[model samples]
Target: MARFSEKKIVAGSLITLGVLFSIIAAFTDCSAGGADNYAHYNIARWAFHYPNLFLDHWGKPLFTILIAPFTQIGFFGARLFNILAGLTTAWICYLLASGWKLSKAWLAPVFVIFVPIYFILMFSGMTEILFSLVLMLAIFLFFYDRFVLSAVVISFIFLARSEGAIFLPIFLTALLFKRKYVAVPFLLTGFLLFSLIGQLYYYHNFWWLITKLPYVGGIGANYGRGSWYHFLEKAPDYIGILIFLFLILGMFVWLKKWFSSGLKLRSEIFTRLLIVAGCFWGYLAAHSYIWWVGEMSLGLTRVMAGVTPVAGLIALVGWSEMDKTIKSKIGKAIFLGLTILFIVLPGVLKYKSEFKADTREVVMDEVVKWLRESRNFDHRFVAHDPYFAFSSKVDAWDSRRIQYGFADFTKPELNIADSTLLIWDAHFSQNEGHIPQKEILDNPKFELVAYFEPKVPLKVLGGHDYCVLVFRKMENLNVDNNQLMIKLKDEQLKGNLVYSEFFDFEHAEPGKVPDQFVVQESDTFSNKCYVLGKDSEFSPSVLLTDSQLKISNEVSVGVEFDFLAEDQLGNNEVLMVFSVEKEDKPYFYQGQDVLAVDSAKWNHARYHFYMPEEVKKDTKVKLYIWDIQKKNLKIDNFRVQAYSK
Candidate 1:
């Protein structure tokens, strides 16, 4: 009875703390909407009116569905949902810790609340808090032997973020290891039922989700790819280095205890620990392949938020074990002081930094006000940031969809007619090849209408300067004549020309592979290049051998290619290659900078490659236009030249 009362007290305290924090979050206007937040808000707003609108594979449908009702109340309601989810997560963490009989079980809830990322996300209106809540609840239910309930919750976790599916295998394996054969079937059934529902409601087949797995895995690849050790490097920023060390130590200690016990300790607590450790390590391993994991600006820490509560619990376990093992009271006290300093100090500092008033709010409000005053309700707007669109209650399209190939801006099917407005900001421009600012600027269709800037200097963390430019499409503008174009004049070429090939396709067959070139197989495209706008995939590469081009000692070599592309959906890249073979071994090198060309026009692209004196004599070169996407393009002139001082 005493233990039951103690558990009840702990639960009550956690609930109270969570509610208090949430109320504080509600009153505080310190929240900032990120790209993900804007996407979530837009999806939620769309869900309020149209049930079948969210058919895209990229949308996290479950989040939008859950938050749709609250979105009518605007950002506050959306943030309130997150706040409640965060508080519930804290309560769930305490329950799990108490069930496991961990020392200082109440501390688990405090840990969840104190984590800076969790605190910040609770107010920012992102899915992390809600996702973490469902995830932890699933774990807690599983430990309590509620297999079917756990399975149902697990399905919701999967819907929250597709990555949550990674936990499914681990959960099933734990059940199998424990000889719970019936539970496995129940879990599988629940998973399939949820997946089928998603397919029906989203109007997509199973393969739609399956095919997007690779795309999700490769997200942010163009920005940068991170090494496997990215998590290790960023650990200090997310959680202090000292606390991270304790977490690692706890894992080692847990392993030693399990192995020494002959691996037969199948207690519920031990199983729970195994599951948590599996999830913590599993998320790190899976995210290592993602390009955004390496880019701190892309929210690498936020990606790890789901597993942070488990880590904190594990670290506390390690700290308790170490405290008990210490022989000297002075030493134990010193260790405790240092641990407190590491864990609490950093979080307090981070909390202060995060809770500051987000200055972007002012700029966003101003832009929305201007739109409401200047534009009619029927006017369509295009913007990278959806917050302005949602706030102003105007029909808007996200430019990112076009940049990422999810939608084509050039296609008339999108309804971007004359009088449409285009808004661009620096934050969205950082993603290379995705920013269509230049295209919008170059086209005479869009004329600059207004530029909005923050009246006061904003110092929000990870905040960029406010430069929101709005452009309105001109009436009766012909998109064909004003299509995006790239031009390189003859004067831009550097050094003396040695050889040039003007490819007029005179000797080459019209539909067949060109002479001196061979087709390379690609999953996205079949042929490298043919007649422009043909059905052939344009990303194919053709190799050239040493017989085609002889290399001489030259300080620099330059190559220029003339190409035409039509109806380009995404970023198109062309590559220039150089190679050498030594002692039957081949060495190949390519130019560093890829020439990016605009769609629906012809381009004269130039690139230079410098050859060292040592390798120039035996070097053999190969040149091919490497199309990054499988868009239709035409090649006319292929020119190569050598240059010396």
Candidate 2:
């Protein structure tokens, strides 16, 4: 009892230290990567408003719930949660160490402190630390014969990260060494009930535990079939050659003793060793991080967070059997040396960064301000680093845009013209294919209005400096093109008659329309306008000839038609006839006009002709369309109507 009490105190101290450091780190400027922290913020908002949809991402609701209150208070709160969770994870590691009867309980805290990647992840608002804590607690409870507590803790671990389910079979296999018959039923019942009730009913995963097996299995298959370099890289760094050496030597000693002992004691030793070894091997093969860079401090921290418990268990078994020889003391020295090596390296690295004090950073303050000022309920901006904007109350793209790694601006769905401002980093573009500067400038429909080089470059994936680019729709700008025209004709008019020729409306063609206007030249073809009127002599011509103001010397004759760009039904010329004479008499008149479309049907139009209230035999009229721009007169569809007085 005295020994147990001492162990608990030591373990508890280690846990407290780790948690305290995590809190301090969180309060510091510890936001590392972009995407994961962004995901935390997004999920927090999602869960706050629609908690029922939590199943869409398995069991991230716990994380969401934890983040909700912090997020409400701003970034400081979220940062604090990250720190607390990281410390809690270290505490769980200490608990596992105590359970395994490891002598140096401080190893867990050292591992957390020295691991650089772990430090980055600690304050990044990611799930790694939270998941690690739950895993440690579940395993500790399982070994303590608290099956119900173990099962609940395991369920929550799985909830934290879908990959946590892989540990279930490993836990069951470990139990085989502890209690043979009990292992089978306990594992089966725990899993079946968890799946049936927690996953299927409460979590809404109908398939339960069985559904989770494939994902775990796939992780194992990937490592077994993947590169040997991957194994070598992650293996030695976290599993430290010294610790494994101890594990192996301890295992041999236990096995030899088991062979010499009587049946019952032998059974107990074998079961304990089997559980410890099986879990170690199974996790190595199945955990997703197996292929990650184990050499990095962060990677080592993650591995040790879980692996230390197994090492501690094996060390305990060896301690029970040792004779306290000089060699045993040397081994202890080696283990302590390894712990110091990991912890000191990271602590030193942090100090080194402090010495440099030249970290480049983005000033997201202006960016966030713009988003809040510019955003509406309906408008969403496509910023490359949307996470920062999202954290600031600005609406951003959906999951489709977030697919893969960064933002893809070229997606056609992003073209809606309701003030679409593309904020991009120039360096980001360079990495993305060096999108041509001319491509944006030459766009007829988009005009670049603003560019800003952030005081500090944004830390984006693919390692590029980032900036903001703004563009506006080109709708309000008038296009100066006397480069467009139209013609109409019909051979059923007579006398001093002239026709007003004009096509009405202006804009792009809506939907699809039959090619009605034939252009005379190839140079006139454009995606904006379909050519229908050609320059064929007999094709269609606008003509004007008239003498209305008592032989006021026949002025030049001309004609013009409105460009049909309105709705397909509303896009036709209205033929209007009016005299250019000083007197309100007819100078010339063309009868009702007809469209000379390829198909002999009058598609759509309204007509106005100037005939006297009572036609005098001598009433004269001139015909022309009112000059728009240059006031060019036009005549076509030759015909004259004579009403005798």
Candidate 3:
């Protein structure tokens, strides 16, 4: 009776600690601008209104489907579900430890929750915690000889994560070794039921398993490919160095015990320990090829979160063995203190750092709130982050995936008659290498609506100078009158407009070069004031000479032009070069970086060149437009000016 009471006290204490951690997670602002979290949230939210939500191949969708109903209570409810999942996982860990007859079973929950990555992800509305919970439950049921129940749980494991199919082999192997033939039929039945559920959800046959192979294969092949030693390199951050060392020690001790007993001892505890070790190593091996495990910015620790409990259990085993070997109480105490300090301190520090307010989430929430209040409820947006789309409850297309075909600055296919809103942030641009700043600012079709700069700078996950900008595509906007006038007025105010050309090309033929400009390398044409790149194989280069302009050494000269382009199948670039004639040779003054422009939209390019003191009286200034890889570019409205400091 006393032992029962002591066990109850320990269980209650662990539950209380779990509840405390959950509360901390609920209130903390640890959410990042991770695309996976947003994708999960959006998919879950979409499942509420849409039928056959699991037809897509992007995500597994079980966690999303489960959380769909509670999402009405807002994102907090989804996070609360994760908290429950995490606590349940810890409970499973405790059960496993108790079954192993560990002296300190209560420490299992502490070790699992205190791992920084697991704790942080538990609050972020990701699928890792839920996956961990289900996987652990399946293992626990298997150990208890509840074969049918274990098989059912194992089926759900695959739904949690695509890679979870690895567990199927592990479970089948275990059952085969134990000679549990009755469980084999139950496992097959569970798999069939799971397939039926997939069919109903996807509105298709059981072809998803086969169809998803290519998609899954493409992920590692295209995006996040890594070497075999990827997980080993990331082990220190996910599980601390000391904990990892202890895990190794635990494996070694288990191996020694098995060999010393002549490999015939089939104790349940030893078999269970072997299974746990297999799971840890198997998960690592399975995910080593994934790019996320190697990529620190994507949170390699989060990717390895499923095996966190196993790591804790291994460390516990090692600690127990060390305690027994150290006969002196003082030596044991010293060893235990060192282990705690080395393992727990790092995780605690990491948790504190991660718990601080995430700048990206805060800024995104602000943007969403503003969009909801300011714009129509039915406004459609083309955005980089789906989180904003989910929060704003608006129809959105991912800019990276969908091409916005702007026919005179309107996407007729999308029924974008009035306007289409565009939302972008620094994180997406930096990570994905898609910079649409020039495209948005230069095009008259897009008007700046709002800009948000984070009050406190983001310090983690490669975040710096974080900012969000919103733009609305203008419909029926006349480029010749409004946009050109604005540019002219702004340039005149800056006191830099020395030479200006609208290039109406009214008198020039379609295939002939304009009278004012000279073709340097490639062919160009003037069609009704629009300079067009005619060469298909090479980019056109055109030169405009200004012999009347004075080349002053002290003043900086600015050359600006507007261009329109057609979307192509490959890469495109625009370059502007400024040169001056010195000693009968053209000397390079300055040039702009290769500027990328959007299709069917007018873009502005500008470059500044400082005149040198060595210029003679015969120096002739020239401006060259180099359409490097770009073809079918319409160039017009050229301006040049000098500004004094």
TM-scores vs. true structure, each candidate: 0.64, 0.52, 0.66
Q: Model 3: which ten-residue window has the lowest total lDDT?
A: 404-413
Q: Worst 10-residue stretch by lDDT in candidate 2?
A: 483-492
Ranking by lDDT: 3, 1, 2
User: Candidate 1: how large is its RMSD?
Assistant: 15.9
Each model's lDDT:
0.60, 0.45, 0.63
Per-residue error at 288 for model 2, in Å? 7.1
**Please, what are the lDDT tens digits per residue for candidate 1 over residues 1-645?**
435676688767766766776677667754444556766776776664556534434456677777878877776778878877877787788777777666656667656666666667777768777778888888888888887777677765766777887888888888887777777766555346645765676645654556544243244443345567777578766765556776887888788777777776475545755688888788767776564454323335677777777777777677667777888979877876676666666765675655644445456676677776865434665665655665565543434222222145543124456676666654553232254555555565666666554423232222343456566667655543222211111222334664554443445554444443332223112234344333443322333334544454443555666565554444224334454445435564553323336654566666555554466344555555555444455665455665444
Q: What's model 3's TM-score?
A: 0.66
Q: What are the per-model numbers of colliding residue pairs?
A: 0, 36, 3
Candidate 1 TM-score, C-alpha based: 0.64
The regions of model 2 sitting more than 4 angstroms off are 1-19, 56-59, 65-72, 105-116, 175-226, 235-277, 287-342, 345-366, 369-379, 384-386, 395-417, 424-645
Q: What C-alpha lDDT, on a 0 to 100 scale, does residue 147 get in candidate 3? A: 82
> Which residue pairs in candidate 1 have backbone atoms (N, alpha carbon, C) closer than 3 angstroms, thus clashing?
none
lDDT, candidate 3, 472-519, per-residue tens: 667645443335434533442344545444343445544444454432
Pick the lDDT winner.
Answer: 3
